[model samples]
Target: MTSSLSLTKKLVNVAMGRESADMVIRDGVWVSVQSGEFIPNTDIAIVDGHIAYVGGDASHTIAQDTKIIDAGGKYLVPGLLDGHMHVESGMVTVTEFVRTVAKRGTTGIFIDPHEIANVFGLKGVKLMVDEAAGQPIHVWVQMPSCVPSAPGFETPGAEITPDDVAEAMTWPGIIGLGEVMDFPGVFNAGEKMMAEIAAARDAGKVIGGHYPNLNLGTIFHGYVAAGIEDDHEGTRVEDAIARVRQGMKAMLRYGSGWLDVEGQVDAILKHKLDSRRFILCTDDSHAGTLTQDGHMDRVLRHAIDAGLPPLTALQMMTINTAEHFGLTREMGMIAPGRWADVLLVEDLNDFHPETVIAKGQVIAQKGKITIDLPSVDYPVWARDSVKLGHPLKAEDFALKTEATVGTPSAPLRAQASVTANVIGVIENQAPTKHLKLEVAVEDGEVSLPLAGGKEGGADIAKLALVERHKATGDVTVGLVSGFGFSEKCGIASTVAHDSHHMLVTGTSEEDMAIAANKLAEVGGGQVVVKDGKVIGLVELEIAGLMSTEEASIVAQKATTVLGGFKACGCTLSNPNMQLSLLALVVIPELRISDMGLVDVINFELIPVIETGK
Candidate 1:
């Protein structure tokens, strides 16, 4: 199962009748992604985890010991591959994610452990790699290149240095460098970023890219020149065309909150770019999406609904992704001498797999995994990562006025109205808006205009980013609008993107403090509080990013959290996803970091108070 040459010899022996075939799939209409046609009456013979023959008939290789499966003339397509994704984002362990998605017509995935890397560094990544290696399905790992994501912007729980990248290049499961989140470093040729890229290049691994809300001209070309290959940050048709035009594979993602596929698929339907250059991925899907609707299967169906041909979408999820990572010879199509990774679906357009085979073994049927997963245990050091330097109190989240702009003679700071910069949240998107609102300065403190703000009015809650890594007890506070809340409620999480700090938003400072301290007391996880009472909590004991709980259990807990959000009078499809990205300094508009408010576009720290300078 490791080497192609080893499996090829066994396949040849089976075809020559020197060895008995282990499995044979009979009478299947081959969904030939290789030829772009469905060839009828295709029979596949497999032996020792490799396909021996794929033709009209395979009676020659059949033996008394061979296990036979009658496909009933169904379309046999290649197993789906999630080109780019993060297992930790599912809020479940690696095993839990595979167990949930395998039955949904997805048999392979390429995972980046950057979320864990930001929490526990190399040791955390090794835990995920080891777990992925033991899964029944095909799981590949990518070395997280940017642990802090953007240096000088925020402090992460851990740091991945060049030496770490070089060592990871030699690991058994490392695929390539994970998405280069440090776009500033790549464009400016930072030494650390360049050394990490050089290590991946020397190891002959593919490099992944992350370019969110970027200009699509020379800067994009500069990033391509730095050896980055593919990107999944595209959310529009023009974004798709931009990446393909630059000779980089454009990864159109359809995660839980990210709805980029519908808008970007027009590049192929209307713009008519080479379909080969487009790929489908789920960069960050949550557990509820996988357990309820589907995984890559859902992505494919949505693509077709958006006017992409069924076969074309399948190609993007299968062969295009496989070829991009140099894994075409191993798993892309249902061809001779390749791994027996096939999905028998009743219909091509609907894409519901009745059976799934991984490495010549039937692992899932319908929507349930039949095989057992690996028994991997995380070390004790991986847990208890939420180190709050001191006990957080309600007063810590208060935003006090420093100096106000008023008359030169009667300069009383408390009497002036200060215009404060706020982080504005967008529904179903990653980027936020920088809003300027004038607030009354009372008792030398900038207080929120909570009386006039309601569900439809211009009211905002206080947002706080608590430093949980160094126990420095640095709490940076800012105002953020967009979570339309009419009640006293708050939510907190350690799953903050890239830097993985503790982000809390609340209408009441007391409720926000309660949620934050509750999560800190549980080591690390997510918590929701309504009217100063705990409503929902999910304990992600592993690095504060992932839970060892079963996928269904975590989904149930998450559902309760969503209910709490609704009860608090805030109604967004995926408010947690929007809340989690508030600390992601890489995205555009404005974000909160440990250093203070960050203007992501300018890549500098701006004062929360406008000062009108």
Candidate 2:
């Protein structure tokens, strides 16, 4: 390791109780997350991207070129950190993600690129890592351990075995293994998953956990025994308590539809559980949510409102997350030798980031990005993620039904195959519902009703999994609810959970086909279709999951799409987010995969309709 002299010298001065620093902020209330206390009248001096001095009045000693900033009684807190998230889920590239989160006081993130890993494997992980290395913020990556998410369950575009995890351990900027989404495999002690966890343990790195089920008995015990360190999928208060009691950090998340923070925090407030083992995360936020609302700042505010003390909530989003990822010495504090990732907030309740600095570099101020972020280019292999093996026609989406020719006069009971386990959309949570709906058969085939409120309207809704990666020309069909999109409108996104395939939802097959093709034509992205025409599109060409363009540009485009959804009578909160996650098989109840519909409860493929009806 190169012994950097600048920061070291500054730290030596601070250790001697002197402030020989390049930058100093005097007269601030330091919200010291380290000890969960606020130190009044503190001065934080910075030199070479690390804190040098953090105590009373440092005006006595300053370098000639040292820049001085007056905190002016503002509350200085450690910049927030996200414990578990996917940069691709924001539909913005790493540069854009950093720019967006920095405005919300998020100085660091531990991202799991499992979405891209499912499609492009290790190379995809490297693409995100390289881009992360370029940002001013701390954007640490985790090697995706469970690609295909569940072996023999779904067919991903790519497969990453334990060998892949070992190979990625050598990559620079890789902190640990990604979320072990294959919890069933772990519970069963599958050789491959166990080997991957073993490799991560051997590398002396963190292994992220994602056991979404509530069976916290032998199965959960098996998972904890398997060496997973942290979990962000806890929905219930008991789930949070169990994870923490088992020595795993419980990451309470508040994303687009996952309102898990309130329930989990109640566990701490009521049961008096250990709050230090908890962290905050936004598992999957859209571009619109990032720009219009905030990131971890929103999570902190929500947690505080949920009865968590302000300082305690801050620690969960800062120091606790930092310590969990083994980056305590590098960040998560305003102490000597820690990176000067600080946020100046006017109100602790609102948690608005007035000014933000990452690694001693001013990145955002007053909700504006000040730094010039570089655009990371995508390779050719990543460009052609959208694939359609065949041209989609209305006939292609038609469900064939057996003719009742001989039994026309007899009592006719048509057998319709509605791929069961409709992935239920839970608001603000990662898990889906296990719902089953049956559709009627018409004219010798199972078919959905038209836009004019036909006979089978209640039983029919269109769900399409457009093959955006590799031009396989495939569109897996299923049905969804809770969107309430009541017109000839379709929402398509490259943000399909885990696999990053194109997920399109429409009442009309023609409109769905048009929207899917439009996204594919743009390389990969999200598009809104109404009346068989494209109204809005957000091009995420970087990896079929994020736009390399500026965050503002992506936000603007996403806003238009949201408006289109509203015009199409979509009443769901963040309609596109609800649509994109319909394919995530890892979460419970029901989900559609590239292969077919998945019963997450059984961890198997189940028919959309029961047989012998």
Candidate 3:
């Protein structure tokens, strides 16, 4: 039970040479994020897990028992921080996500578990908060502000009200209300959304913002007036400029699927806006990306390649993020009174950490974790979240039509072409296209093009949203394009964004049924079925969103799922991530949920087929 006063006293003593430090790193080129300069031949000393002294030589504070680390003239930068992210998107639990990213120089993360919050409500957020507290690095939790994201568009397993937000504000590790995604609710003065924002403001917490609407008119101005502090949903340079102009931090994200940094970083690079108001984050990263590539380190490399100076890019992920969260005195830079989190890198251009230290202890070396992370034991109820009323069949995914020309007893089928409203997927982006395509009808149901039709042929496939929460046996079926599935394959996942329902999309209804049933049997996860055979699977038994298995194992299994998509002729990169978002009804212009197809531009339910037009 060390008090803050006592810790400060110890740090002061070590700085004044009255006490010795626990660890010392000598002779390093310090990348000073505070002054945005690189100082040569600097040393940092740590005491009681806090930086006590940082300047020239610290021989006076060093003792024989103090562990010494020779940086060998390496660039000593602050440990990276991801200001906004979702741990469930990695398909692994918090502990596993930490194990994979901590070694890659990410010492702190701000996680909004809205994905799990939609499933288990506040209890799920508490689960993530408790798990976050045991990590060696700093992990802050944000109370999910949007449960279903958009009300009346989708039904979640649980709902989070303003009462939940006020109650969570009193709990430890809750930094702020997680991204107020309901821009309509905010600008429209919706009571529930206003109350949530009021609770966070009364508690003196930061209010996260998510204004995906590209219109920077009166609506955007009203949204900014609701006391939102930051936004990460911006994709255009103008979007970045508008956010910064409204005194909001513009967070440029580079995720596993969404590559938005290159498109938005020019706000600082070309428009010459102040870089301090801009932050870097990964809104969602998959398990395979964390295991194979890197985490914040990858974003750093990408930012640098986008023509940002190394120190400027490092500032965006470090001090800029810390200041945005009101944690400047806590853990952002290599300064006195801050936590001793630092990274030693030999090259700034490539940005690979040779040694990673957090809270005055060496945790990883050369892209591998050396410290033992604590394992979490999830409750039994979380493991049993996938509750289906009954087993699914091919008929469950059928889209029936009433265009029959004869009676039921002697039904005569007409080869009629109907104008169908399809959810079109744009690669590496969150927004989808509302496409109207003509498709052939057969046997009173919508017919799909045969497998291996041709290169660049029709990519329409059946998309179904099966309710798995209370098991109402409701399956809303629709049509989607841009998966490019040219085989008898189906892909099902319980990792549907915002609601966490079951999403099954494929060319074959029989294979779609198989994929959906397989996930229910294994509890929850993503699975691929090709040619009536199970091709790949990753079992996520925790809250139906994250796996208890190690991240490497999950990554390996997820790789096979990606390979399965390639075998099915879907050439989109990170298609599983795209598949998961098919149920996210927040983004424009179209999406699918358990209710029906959503026209996000109008924020209403539209028919699968265009009738009047």
Candidate 2 lDDT over residue span 447-516, tens digit each: 6554334342552467877666667777677777666665767778888887767787777777777887
Model 2 local distance difference test score: 0.80
Q: Cα lDDT for residue 437, model 3?
A: 90
Best by TM-score: 3
Error of 3 at 104 (Å): 0.8
Tens digits of per-residue lDDT for model 3, 1-613: 5599999899999988899999999999999999988988899999888899999898889989998999999999999999999999999989999999999999999999999999999999999999999999999999999987999889999999999999999999999999998899999999999999999999999999998888899999999999999999999999999999999999999999989999998899889999999999999999999988899999999999999999999999999999999999998888999999999999999988999999888999998899999977789988888887999999999997764344445443567667799999999998899999987778778988854565444779999999999988899999999998888888999999889999999989999999999999999999999989999998989888898888899999999899989988889998999999998888889999988999998999988965432
> lDDT (0-100) at residue 288 of candidate 3?
90
lDDT of 2 at 476: 76
Candidate 1 structure lDDT: 0.88
Give candidate 1's error at residue 19 in angstroms. 2.5
lDDT of 1 by residue, 441-483 (tens): 6777766645334533356888899999889998999888888
Candidate 1 Cα outliers beyond 4 Å, as residue runs:
1-6, 413-416, 451-457
TM-score of 3: 0.98
RMSD of every prediction: 1.7, 2.6, 2.1
lDDT against the true structure, per candidate, is 0.88, 0.80, 0.92
